[model samples]
Each structure stands twice: as structure tokens, then as C-alpha cells.
Target: MCAAYGEERASRTRINPAVLILGFKIHRSLRMQQSNKPEEQSASILRSR
Candidate 1:
């Protein structure tokens, strides 16, 4: 219920251009390692549920 809503919001926020740019920079800095911050964000959002 609320968890689903939080997940949706997290996905929406991550799709923002600013977040995309930040993701690109982070990916470059990590040399292409997978990103976990977004997952963490989603998790935090779920916790708020």
C-alpha cells in the first residue's frame, strides 16, 4: 500500500534530470560500479511507510 506509493515516488524522483546527472557523475567516479544510493533512497522511502 504505502510501500508501493513510496516506491513510486522514489522512482519518480530518481528520474529527475538533476538526479540523472548526479547518477552519471557518480557512475563515472565509481568507474561503472552499480549504484546503490537509489536503492537506499527507495528503502528509506519504504521505511517512511
Candidate 2:
């Protein structure tokens, strides 16, 4: 029973970091998109002028 519990924990631990990394990547990309929009708008405005 202890071994099974340990195996379950190990599997969970293995999966957790991948989940965290994916979440972090998605968060970073979302932030990048948010941060980039104003710069893009300004660039377009300059081009229009």
C-alpha cells in the first residue's frame, strides 16, 4: 500500500512540472501579446502618418 502511494506521488510529481512549464509559457505569451499591442498600434499610426 505504501509503495502504491509512493508511485502515485512520483507520477504526480513528474506531471506537475510539465504542467507548470506549460502554464508559464502560456502566461508569458499572453503577457507578450498584451505588451506588444501598443507598440504595434504606434507603429501603424506612424506608418499612416
Number of colliding residue pairs in each model = 0, 0
Q: What do the candidate models score in CA lDDT, each in turn?
A: 0.62, 0.66
> Which residue pairs collide in model 2, if any?
none
Number of clashes in model 1?
A: 0
lDDT of 2: 0.66
Q: Mind giving the per-residue lDDT tens digits that candidate 1 earns over 3-45?
A: 4454466587647777557656655766434335788669768
What TM-score would every model get versus the actual structure?
Answer: 0.37, 0.42
- Candidate 2 C-alpha lDDT tens digits along 1-49: 5444545665677667776576567667766666668887798789999
Query: Which predicted model would earn the best lDDT?
Result: 2
- Candidate 2 to native Cα RMSD, angstroms: 12.3
TM-score of candidate 2 to 2 decimals: 0.42
